[model samples]
Target: MAHAESVRVVFVDAETEEEFARTELAPGQLPDSFEYETRLDLGGESWAVVRADPPSAAQFLRSGSLVLTLRRIQTVDPQEMAYSLPTIFDPLPPTEDSTGSGEHFVIHEDDWRQAELVSRQLAGQVEAEMRAIHEVFRQSSRVVGEGASSMRVFDRIHVRRTPIDPLSTEVSLRRLSELLPVGGRPYAGVRIGDDPGRVVDSFVIAADPLVVYGQALGDRVTVLCLAPLLDAATESAAGLEQAMREFDLVLADWCSGRLLDASAVGAFLNQA
Candidate 1:
């Protein structure tokens, strides 16, 4: 594939600083198109989330600081036929900001920089531990949350098939199947406990390499490379910085189209 259709950086924490986030972060600074306030409460256990969508980018700031996700949707015209535009999932409920001036969410050439800055800023205001960082690629059939607990974070690659205009279900399935081998239940998916270098692992959640049934309108088979976080015991500034650096290595390999069976996936994505 040429590059990701869209990339998102997500920050996870152990605490829910709903009031503090709402009160301190300004909402007015964001673009008016993002709307003044949107409230969303998924009910028990789920953190209350809020969303702000500007022309250049989109943001998800949740209650209790469960997570904060920043995404930049890449644009591809209909003629391109590679990927869909983008989908913006709703954020948590709105908070009460004393300043009422929301933070300015901008997409830079380097997303890592923005991610690091957000992690640092959030850590300064709250006592929550920086649990994990997630990088999401959307509208991408070839690639792919949160918590402060002592769980190992996996850097994953997701490959899926989504319906774009003019491509019917039958046609989409046929087109995608041509790229990889289709198989029965036994060979439907494969998982390599240890990666090529024994540095990571790989898993195929669904076997759509050639063909399969029960595929949703927007989701087909997906293969993921789960990169484990080895040195994330600390949640301080130093810890976060180290994690970010390690993540960069994983992201770089994925982006370069060099992971397990990446060549096969890339060939599929390159098709018109």
Candidate 2:
């Protein structure tokens, strides 16, 4: 929890939910304990609003049972706060480091054994997703040009995957390589050919959260910003993977600009 108190909204059904809100009675802070469970219909066939002090719940009844969630207000230290915000300076260093030769996390044999088992499962998923992404580009039309010229800097580089052409892959690859993050990583993968240096980070199966920054050299690095959805993968890794593909197709395309010419948006419906 944050040093400053926060409230969590929750939903409960058919039972009185009890939570512990602190008894300190600070006007804007969270209580140590709380209890707010009652039947107040939210007026839908499946939803209800249950209020309990600072803790509120809105839930839905699915197939005759209430789906309940206790939203938690979490806290982060100063470092996480800084990193999350866009800054003009270099990111702060790691506050803590672990050699792991110490007390916690181990008993070694058990840990490694558990990891090895999970690795086997995830390995298959990684290969399958990569193959699918590659195949989509292989079958689709080649997307041309650097995204938006104004958004890129001389030092910034971009890597793109698009359809392979029968006569000239080199010309397209040359144009695409112009936008990669310079000196950050090499361009490493392409869908259509045996081009060298195609996989930028062969192991960068997912994007790191883009820290919006102005580099020391007076150039800008505008990243595609897929890092947030990448983290979302921990809860549902499959969702993370699917989102990455969809983002490339949807959000990313629109980021280039607009797909339709509009007068007031409705104007385009009767376009010639």
Candidate 3:
């Protein structure tokens, strides 16, 4: 198992809703760790986005709307920090020399079984939910710089459906960009097709947190989140893997809308 600097799980709405706000939400629905919070006015109504700062954990929950994120950051020395930091000038390097930097994972049959266990714990069950399925994987590596310092890089690939199609990939990628918070230099290119369906083609590059690529199918969308490892490293690779797996388990629940269940959420909030 490889060590992870941090693990982040996010849920995004396919379309923006006008009526989301923090004021309308009950504080009990949010995690207690969320001490610092703020709201943004999109259109005339107030759309609330709250954040809480806890050691090693961070959450950004947008109320009445479509985005929620859970992040675990790894704190490292300046030299180690180089391994995961993202710079505006540098485009993502080709995956030739940094082979050992990361790993790839796919949601498997056993994973679905584990998710079913999580669903069983939920009290308020999901009534009607979208059947969209999302597959997420990560690639991590350390890149040496001009000096002795190195930056750690994390690349995530999220796919909705399989059987890659060229025309579909192109059109889906375009629509994915439309939903993001705009304002960045646009970059695109095609990667070799041998690794179809995955983010094996052209992508976008921007400052630190980059939305490398996004593709949609039917009502489901796939997006890539690439950035530096911003958390402290664990003592062992197994420990890191444990942390990642736990996050992935919850992620499966979130994708299934099981996380919206009141009882199920208690478990996620209680996790350290």
Candidate 4:
């Protein structure tokens, strides 16, 4: 087996591309594994490892060290975060068609199965959370419909609630699976509203608590909430339940027409 006397890991800001820190690991202290999005602790701060210049462990063994780029966890965007596990094969290069339009990359069956497992897990979590949220509205709301991924509730008003798994949607999954891959990390969340192109509210399970209010006119969607949901970190279902309890209150107000716009939702989240 190839081995290195020492390994030097350099950390850089993902956004600024500036080196923030570097560490040298003796052969005995070398990490068992290193991969994209792996979190490292440096100076009491969390950083996500993004890239390795030599690219592989074998290369590191031959070279003894490689450059690593990392982004501060706090500065990472939720949308850019890796939601899926890494796949075994790189996407095949696009091939030109007769008309010169390139063909889409094909996903491997194993990768598809991996992504499907993640999608199912996320769907289950969403359903479970929605059920819990539904209980809060039990007195005033009645169920109109229910499915594997969504539920419809009606009080004096109607709302469709669903778990938003961008990975499960045929369109989104096909497009994003190449980027996000399939992973155990939870990236799925819930949405409550009538349509994505209209007034809607959603919560995303991210590094931070994220609640968004959205409204759309034609093809343009406008976001209303500028505040994070409650001052609490909601990375798990338990944390989400607590946030949802608070959200139910705001949703109740929205259903009653007291809070009519995204600004109201933003105010409620900021206050809470």
- List RMSD in Å for every model shown: 25.6, 22.3, 27.6, 19.6
Residue 23 lDDT, candidate 3, scale 0-100? 29
Candidate 3 clash figure, as a count = 20
Clashing pairs in 4: 84-182, 84-183, 85-182, 85-183
User: What TM-score do all the candidates reach, one by one?
Assistant: 0.16, 0.15, 0.19, 0.30
Q: Each candidate: what lDDT? A: 0.24, 0.24, 0.29, 0.39
Q: How accurate is candidate 3 locally (lDDT)?
A: 0.29
Candidate 2 structure quality by residue, lDDT tens digits, 22-69: 222232433232354333223333333333333322111111112233
Top candidate when judged by lDDT against the true structure: 4
- Model 1 TM-score? 0.16
Give candidate 4 misplaced runs (Cα > 4 Å). Answer: 75-272
**Residues 1-272 of candidate 3: C-alpha lDDT, one tens digit per residue:** 23223333233222442222222233344443434554433445443343322212223232222234222233456544422221111122132221222222222221211122122122222222212222221233334455666443523212222111212122233433443333445444323223322233324433213222322344333323222123312222222223234323222242323333223333432331
Q: Which number leads on TM-score?
A: 4
In candidate 2, stretches whose alpha carbon ends up further than 4 angstroms from where it belongs are: 1-42, 45-67, 70-182, 190-272
Query: Model 3 Cα RMSD, Å?
Result: 27.6
Candidate 4 lDDT over 1-272, as tens digits, reads 76777888776788999887788877555444565447777789887778777766677767887787877777766544431211211221122222222222222322211111112224454345444434435544443435774443433222223333312312222222222212223422222222112112221213245432222223322211222335533232233233333222112222222322222433444455
Error of 1 at 131 (Å): 14
